[model samples]
Target chain A: MLAKEIIKKIKDAESNITSVIFVGCGASKADLYPAKYFLEENSTKIRTSLYTANEFNYATPKAVNSNCIVITASLGGTTPETVQATSKAKSLGAYVITLTHKKDSPITKDADYVIVHGFEKSYAEKLEKMIYALQLAVEILNQFEGYANYEEMINGFNNIYDLIEKSAATVLPQAKEFANSYKDENVIYLMSSGATHKVAYSTSICLLMEMQWMNSGSFHDGEFFHGPFEIVDKDVPFILFMNEGKTRPMDSRALTFLKRFGAKTTVIDAKDFGITSVISEKVADYFSPMLISGIFRVYAEQLAIARNHPLTKRRYMWKLEY
Target chain B: MLAKEIIKKIKDAESNITSVIFVGCGASKADLYPAKYFLEENSTKIRTSLYTANEFNYATPKAVNSNCIVITASLGGTTPETVQATSKAKSLGAYVITLTHKKDSPITKDADYVIVHGFEKSYAEKLEKMIYALQLAVEILNQFEGYANYEEMINGFNNIYDLIEKSAATVLPQAKEFANSYKDENVIYLMSSGATHKVAYSTSICLLMEMQWMNSGSFHDGEFFHGPFEIVDKDVPFILFMNEGKTRPMDSRALTFLKRFGAKTTVIDAKDFGITSVISEKVADYFSPMLISGIFRVYAEQLAIARNHPLTKRRYMWKLEY
Candidate 1:
């Protein structure tokens, strides 16, 4: 019911505050249209933070205030974080905006603006639709003066989606091979540089959240030199992601280090792997590689199933004891 | 025994590189000092890529060439990655440099230069001594010509140790209370923005690798709006590393969001907690937040131990299956 009000909230908040902080989980992202990368690619001047739900109780004054607006994303609307953080933001004087599937859902009721969408299906469809709705909502918000032909920018979304489709075709087979290599291997190591650092983070997260229930972690190339080197072994399988020139040796050396540990190591190039390329150089200046790396949702699904997790609905979503 | 040589190797490469590629795994990073961050923070012309080990195998042209130099880090000097990548770099005519703690490490024999180091036993001592060694090595490499003044930086190292000791005195004790709050509860979330992002990432990794036996993840305040909202729970325990000034609202909102999910989020503010205050603002720009965030390590330990998992020694000096 508040979907229309959603645009008004975002528009009004555009310039007044000293800064705008965009906060959401993965579902809050904008769609690239034909592409899914747009959500992570856009240039946002606002102050922003994205973290799992129910984790912000410790925020400093710099992170919350009356001038601020909190936008949260989740399909079910009843997620523990949505229920708690939204309520708290309002108590703290910050307006709350939520993008979800139902206006009646738990996360939406207290929102100053709520964009209720139907993109609530399996994970893949969930991404396609949620991103689409958010992009449209964002487009409407851009309608005020000085908002350049935002539609044109949103149109590029298609290019990203097309690229993802193509990349899936190319990398899927290879990813399958990589998955098999690590099947019984116990641990799969992901190493990356550039914007890919974010991807490594997301991929590792997915491995824990829905994919392989294995021991996993990510690191910036040279950072590993600080301590992680003590555990490298032949049985651990490692994967390195390299962007053209930015982190050449960093990502490369990770491959070498894995070999020394006796783990099997594989490398993925950002250029050849276009699907997740939503993280391409387009949004490079705004973020580290992990922004685009979230696209590994696709790659993660494959690996998840490869590890026999397959992320079924039967798998309890929250099942929180608290 | 080879620690001195390892330092020399790093120092030697600082000037030789026209374009440098830095690489290693998450664990090997225990010994690395941010020479690249330091170099890039100071000079804009030099190209650098600090990557995780095993990432290079997938790198593009700029990553490997006769002119490019590749450096890999491994604490044990035997990460499977370092060995594999060293051979590749050599075959490609790229100079190879290895940094580690063992002179007899398998990685040492093949590298063009090998450097090694070991730390003292106490928690603070191990971290402080190793960090100083890395600084000594990189500072010398960053400006080998200014080796004379390098001693000044090493002198400052002891000051950092004193700062950590002071902070740990107050920070660690309070962490016990925070840790107790979540010990019986399920889930732990970590979040932050900017350099604090590294803290969030590192926090997640530390929990998983060290004490955490449950769930955790990181997201930017701005990006969390897209999707992660679905998982929030009212009872899940979490923390937000609120950076001072520009990055707080999102942090606060994240806290709010978590509360809405029925979870309580804790925040560690750098400004109020004497975190950013301990170090000079300039140094705080690069390192203070990480130290502040490490406070979670103690809390995580308490949380895990409550559940009987307790951060133990097994994952500490992880021995590879070589």
Candidate 2:
């Protein structure tokens, strides 16, 4: 019934919806990755782009139109840029969809559609819940766009929590080992591609840098052979996400190179996680990043503990004006 | 005459080109940034996306079509991925324009248009020459697309060499000071937005990480506040690229925060250079990255000298097979 209702409203807007833009800030940026992946890979019917709330609010790329659909997610729903961008999108006559943990949050005031989830106990929980909300929107839109694999995702959607829970349980020991081995390292490089690239990027920024106070950056597997791979040596540590998708070969190339160079490499492979049991094989790739993100949440926590830094501890985040 | 010849061919194919994708690897990735900026900001007539040659060759985004025009650049033109992707673009029935330092490069064999520049004696010269070729294509395409600012860019094109040469001279002292002050630091953060964001990203990867063997990553200025800023402490150094563009306010916000937090900050502002005198004020933003990049090449060289690392030194790049 909920999906039908949302689909009906989108159908009513179908004539006017020429573009779709996903806007978010901070950890909230990770929440919209699924929708972005969906729109980019599946939606040949509409123009799509994702932007940080700050960029969206500032220049407002010419992609936004009077008939555009602007989707934003903020866990606290009080991020200044996301709220402001929501208002700006509204003023531009674009339809706004705001996802938040709080039903009556700041962004809701300016959004046309508001999806709220129950309370989250931790940042990881918030991310998982928000991703679920965003992916639901993606599947509905995918069905509308007549993607052949829509049913696979729709069926798989029902078991997302199960898949993530199972994935976390299976990945915990490996994650703990990873955290213990690399906790003292000053810098780390993460590599992945396709839908999983967001997880590599966001985890490096939000968890490694922000939570654990470690220096880290994510490089696309496809672009790894470019200048970024020059940093590879026996002394450097690499964390590669090996997903079972079209982009898997790219990651494999990076993994082979890192292994050859004797770089200390840790792999988080989606194939080992039993994703096919929970999701259709056809759409398992679509959920690889979500599953990997679940595994990484545990890794980040263990990393924080091993490094003697609390995930909640921050030098400037909530304590200062920045 | 070269511009006219290229312009005529593009004009003849203009009706077929509904999309333009810029593809490259390593430093060549920086060449297409101007074309991406032009299309994203100035052209509602065509869809544009920038992709690494690896990604472009592997999972070509749904955007590439028979009606697509793909532009790619490689200095040596020997990068296997770039050459392969150029061929793949041609196979897709997309028009391919390849820029290289060598007139008889590998990619030239697969391209519809091959633009070559003379040999460069230094890394900085190579970048300048590559960017010149790429921007020439962007301006000519802009003219075909009826962008009003195209004329200004055409006029300004004649003065780019002088502008960059002057900008390099003006920013040299500041760059040397930056190199001297931060040579010992292993990790640094770079931030910029809009057209300059590519410069920030590329400089960090190519110059600081690859060439200088230092650790660095770039963040979009608008996304700085989200979570990456949490890593900022008084000890962490940040290089901020401040351009006179619509995204200036976003960078300003981050700069204001960093200044208040007392972080070591390096500011490379376009306005500090004489770019406005070399180009029309309306189109000066288009040249901001080019100017800043010229300044950074000197900074990177000085940094390599201070750190006792040669820019040509590499651990795995070209030394190992991936």
Candidate 3:
């Protein structure tokens, strides 16, 4: 179904929806986070949760019932755990929506709606899963509980793809530099807050660790002062994502600490890429992840090239039953 | 206030409560996860959230209101972020409960109730913050929506300290062995699911990285298959916490893959220490974290000793303000 059609269906059923749950595995799970975070931050009446697919199935929340909306995704739509989760949520009478790059896959079989996203297309097309899930959150809040920045969100979506493409091009030089400098590092740590937190996470797990076989970890920038800051030292490589949102102070604080401690750091600020140029400041934070998603894919590709490793290389995934 | 007194007050206000929010930092934040997890798994009516203290203050949830219960903790009760969060929650009309080891700490200033938890006395005493928060969850559920395992939970709590002590003793030899084997390792990865997920997380951030200055990362066992498992290979050191909960199968599956790949793993199973002997099989999952918390402290202490690094040793914490 088209994204607009999906939104229309949800708008028709908004009165019965009391909660939203996002579930997937790996990158898909990480990608769902922005949508969950967006709904949690804005909606006063709707409860939101994000869980890895298997955990959602194994320890299903009691809130997964007729009143809940479950948004799930799988790249190929064949992830067993996610498929099972879709079936379970459907059985529990949740309005299940599944996003995938393949049409009519197993995951779509149990979903109330299926959005076949694109990968080998434009940057915005490639981010359909994240964008669609995020749009659903925006529309749900706007229709059900009322959102003040609804028009701004819609405008931002219209310009986000072009903005992301332009941002990706602007960051290519730095991406190459980062690839050369960080390719041989023993371990890399990523940190971010607000909407871009899961962008850093997916970059760490899927792009860096899985693709490059490098040790990586990601933490919320808000958590830096807690215990994670203890790990900083001279020349310690760090990647920090600074948001253009209410939590931006947390990211800036961490950056100041990293610089003061002489740690080698790379800062990916949404403001640096002119995110606010197209996205209204009122609703820019929710669109930051879409820009970061496009920009980081360029970075990850450069890193793969620098390390002489293809993004498709995998040690155990799909080569064996795991 | 005594734990029972706190429970009585919550019971008195049960009908007015619609949500629960747990906030703290570092170890305290980590300790609050079990309560959040427990409430999420069992409560259908109440919404629950856990956040780092600063995040709670910066981007306060809109759900904080007269109908919300906020449980926050800071060991010394002087963490600026947590104190501010306590004040913020109170100002928003949420019933704020503060837990601290110091009676008149700053965090207690705006709290509706203050529970001065004990430390430096006994194993169970050191875990008062976690226990009290958990007990509050149990009581709230029992009084509000009703829980079938209430008696078992209370019984488990009564015997938990003794069970934890016994479990710590049983794991002493292995802790020492782990200290010797893992002392020089560059990075240690920990994994668990359900109730024990944050136990592994706290061990990584607080014990391993902050205390030992070793690189560390932790992931949920459910997420291991997603992207984290790519880093698993021969001799890769992992500390896996296996729960006795509904999600135990997730941990077991990860363990099987780790063993098959010849990855060095230290499996800490709640059943190993006879947790079900004291905690009924039905409620054993909720008690697994308490047992793991005590047992892992022993393991962390052993690692500290073997590395000649005291747990109190710090590079920048308290010495310099960021």
Which number leads on TM-score?
3
C-alpha positional error of residue A172 in candidate 1 after TM-score superposition, expressed in Å = 16
C-alpha lDDT of candidate 2 relative to the true structure: 0.76
- lDDT, residue A52, candidate 1: 39
Q: Write the per-residue lDDT of candidate 2 for residues B1-322, one digit (tens) a residue.
A: 3655775677676654666778898667866786677666655446566777876776676666677778888888899999999999888788788888888889899899888765456434645544565564565566556667767877676766666676677666777799899999979889898778878888888888888778888878887877788888886899999887667888889899898878899988888876777689777767777777877777887888888899899877777566
Docking class of 2: medium
Query: Candidate 1 or 2, higher TM-score?
Result: 2
Off by over 4 Å in 1: A1-322, B1-16, B29-42, B58-61, B64-71, B86-99, B111-120, B126-158, B209-212, B220-222, B243-262, B272-278, B313-322
* Poorest 10 consecutive residues by lDDT, candidate 2 chain A: A118-127
iRMSD for every model: 10.2, 2.0, 1.3
lDDT per residue, candidate 3, B1-322, as tens digits? Answer: 2655675776687566877889998889988888999888787777788888777777788789888889999999999999999999999988889989999999999999998888887777778788888988887777778899988888988899898877787778999999999999978999999888898988888888788988988888898988889998999899999988788999999999999999989988887888777789888887888888888888889999999999999998899877
Listed models, DockQ each: 0.08, 0.56, 0.70
lDDT of 3 by residue, A31-143 (tens): 88888887776666677788888889988988899888899999999999999999999999898999899998999999999888888777667677888788888877777
Q: Which number leads on DockQ?
A: 3
Docking level for model 3: medium
- lDDT tens string, model 2, A1-322? 3544665687676654556778898667766776676566555446566778877776776666666778888888888889999989888878777888888899899888887764455433545544565565564566456567767776776776777776777667877898899998989988898778778888888888888778887778887877788878886988898887677888899898888878899988888877787778777767788777777778887888888899898877777555
Judge candidate 3 at residue A215 and give its lDDT: 90
- Among these predictions, the greatest lDDT belongs to 3
Query: What overall lDDT goes with each candidate model?
Result: 0.51, 0.76, 0.86
> Per candidate, chain B TM-score?
0.71, 0.93, 0.97
